[model samples]
Target: MKREIENKSKKKVIIKRQDECLRPSIPQFSVFEIIRATNGKLIAGSDDLSVSGVSTDTRTLSRGNLFIAIRGKNFDGHNFINQAIVKGAQAIIVESDFRFDASQGASRINKDNLSLKDCASVSFIRTDDAIGALCNLAAFHRRRFKIPVVGITGSCGKTTTKEMVADVLSAKFNVLKNKGTFNNSIGVSHTLLGLNKEVDIALVEMGTSNFGEIKRLAEIVAPSIGIITNVGYSHLEFFKTIDSICNEKYDLVKNLKHPFIAILNGDDMRLRKKAKTSKDLNLFTFGLKKTCDFTATNIECARGVLEFSLNKKHRFKINVLGRQNAYNVLAAISCGVIFGLNYKDIKNKLSAFIMPSTRISLKKIRGYHVIDDTYNSNPLSLEYAIQTLSEFDTKGKKVFVMGDMLELGKRSVMLHREIAKKIIKSGIDTLITVGPLSHHAADAIKTKKRSNLKVYSCGCTLEARGILLNLLRDDDLVLVKGSRGMRMEEIIEDL
Candidate 1:
């Protein structure tokens, strides 16, 4: 009787296994697909083999993953290939000329005297350039999903605009956005590769400092829609002039294939000029002016919340503080409208969208109102932040803790002095400058000899923190901003 019962249970198990085998499964990439995408030589690995996922960092590599060794400034990922293999990376992509050096522990012996290759079923792929190959693979993956990709680029407000656009679009579709401010080549590639059949839209932010960067990113993104927030003096050290910056940023629009939408900031003179000449593209303009295709009017800001109407018909509100953010919202709304999202849905999504941290986030520390904009800064963003700070309703004195706006090259001193002039005009009662370039600002203040203002110049963030700790008052509203290298957020942390 017991044998008869065991036979019945085995039959049931076999029937269930057969049912699962008959079910259709999602098609995953084969080894040949990776070879085709990367144009790489299969050093070791079967053509029919499949990997679970792709990764660059060995620390996070899981079983059946494909690892691409990226060579960065401080670390060479080739050094970690052995660890990745031990952690169960099924395949590895390395430079074509990379060699397995015995001194670097590339070889291991097993109890049966088998080599590393004989002991495990790992595969090796060789590419002429590992990073380029990774990007190619990502582009290939992106091609499989036929979703709308919105590529955003500009010197400032790219991240904020990307977030707002993603939020508004999420109301109608499943959205995949660039995480944080990862807007560089590696970042954009990784973001594009994250797409799958589930995603309905991709919002990518492209950031650049020199020529060809935006073009390369755009080629990989192949966006159906492009957004240029506004050109500014962000990376002048590398670009040298505003014209060069504009040319680099406009690459996104230039790369967009026909039957695409190009959103321009009508208020930005450079973009406005470009829109005039771009007759071949489907152009949409958004700004405060009524002439814009999508216009925001009747603007109001109270208690750090912004309320505005689009063409005097669609009303929207955002909690982020600053009039500059209103332009970003307008850009997002224009994108939503282009995607056929109703104004009501766009407004509802944006109204609940929270601002990204460290981009003009307002907070109360101890008892002081602190405007933290220290993620990164250039002349244009600094001016907007200072202007916003000046307009805030404050019974107490307004103070600014500023650091060097880096990458200005030869124009650093001139720009710093210009900022000092703006600071003086903004009615700031107290100013603390950090970093070497900011010394020019302090000198400009001294040259002006304002009796009502107090100025302090510090060599580094630590010194700035000490001075701010002693100088800050409970009633003061302080604004802190600087380039990423200056780490201006330290003062805010110390306070």
Candidate 2:
């Protein structure tokens, strides 16, 4: 199950990961228990009831429990409040200020006094902030269980690294991991709620587009181990600058108070410099640099597998693409090593790591090569995808199918142009840009060379798909990438 919880408060928390985290003894709350927990301060009304599982949606609310009616940007949960009651929700938790003025023509229309069966049993609790209250409850549940957690955050590779770390650690422990990008407030909260008593380890990937998000996630996960993949330009629209991005991403690291194990990319000088302040914690560094604790030397990318020797371990192969992923794999390996896994065991498990969807996924269609890294993109990410595409073995031309990199803010044009220059230098034979912002990149490519290299600038995904289908031959290698908003993965399906 996927869910996220965020704390808007900026307070930093310091804590150690405990061994007894995944105890299966579920926190069973009765209808009366919830009513009593929120009695004096939670709501003005005295109605109290209990149920199973907290829900923000009326459609999914279960019987005999609390239904949190939260107001969102697009939809209001209040509209479905009655539906939740009919669906078996015993109590409702609405925002405290939610008012109904009978004279305003809003209250009498819906008959606000509708009661449930067996006379005034359904309870309604009001809170100033439903989301915050929910987060507090999740944190309370976490402390109650005492689960060991490893929280990971970065501008990129958060999901991939989380999966790798979980997989590597799971080879030994019964691990519970946060699914997908469920690193936000709601996602993190839901992940914690899913935790039963049997889980031995919790691996959560914390992602943030703005400040204070990771900080909130850290409070919920309270990881003893923290991993920061190399930070890059992601969510620039929300952050406005790279420095701000770095500071926001480091929010999780600064909050840890345990014998906190920090795994950092030694290659990223910025990240390395930041690691200095974290010196009080037990630090493990990973990169290709000779000075690092875990370093990869003699890296080679052949076919779809990448072979690299780490700390002189001769035989290590990763199923993912890109030399840049040496950084990602090194982080995962460092985590395994810190957890007391032998070098040989870590090396053997490296081969089991698969690229998550839309991240350098290689496929063969009608003898042509298609590299689908279309999950999302930035100027830096596109450059790495180009490098990976350049290494693919193919009998025919190399094709690049790209979409606009969203959230770049003011630097979108310059960044797009750089992508164009890199593609030209990488010897791409064809370029199909899916959105208008990508015109800058395509124009840059057209300025330098004209050796039968086709640059087609399309207005949208449908047009790009048409161009690619007509232009690609049976033996060409095509790499598709774009921001999440562009939905570039659709093109991959068409191919």
lDDT of 1 by residue, 257-299 (tens): 5446788898888887876777567777788887787788888
Query: All candidates' lDDT scores?
Result: 0.82, 0.75
TM-score of 1: 0.91
Candidate 1 ranges beyond 4 A from true positions = 1-28, 101-120
Specify the highest-TM-score model's number.
1
By lDDT, who's the top model here? 1
Give me the overall lDDT of model 1: 0.82
Steric overlap count per candidate:
0, 20
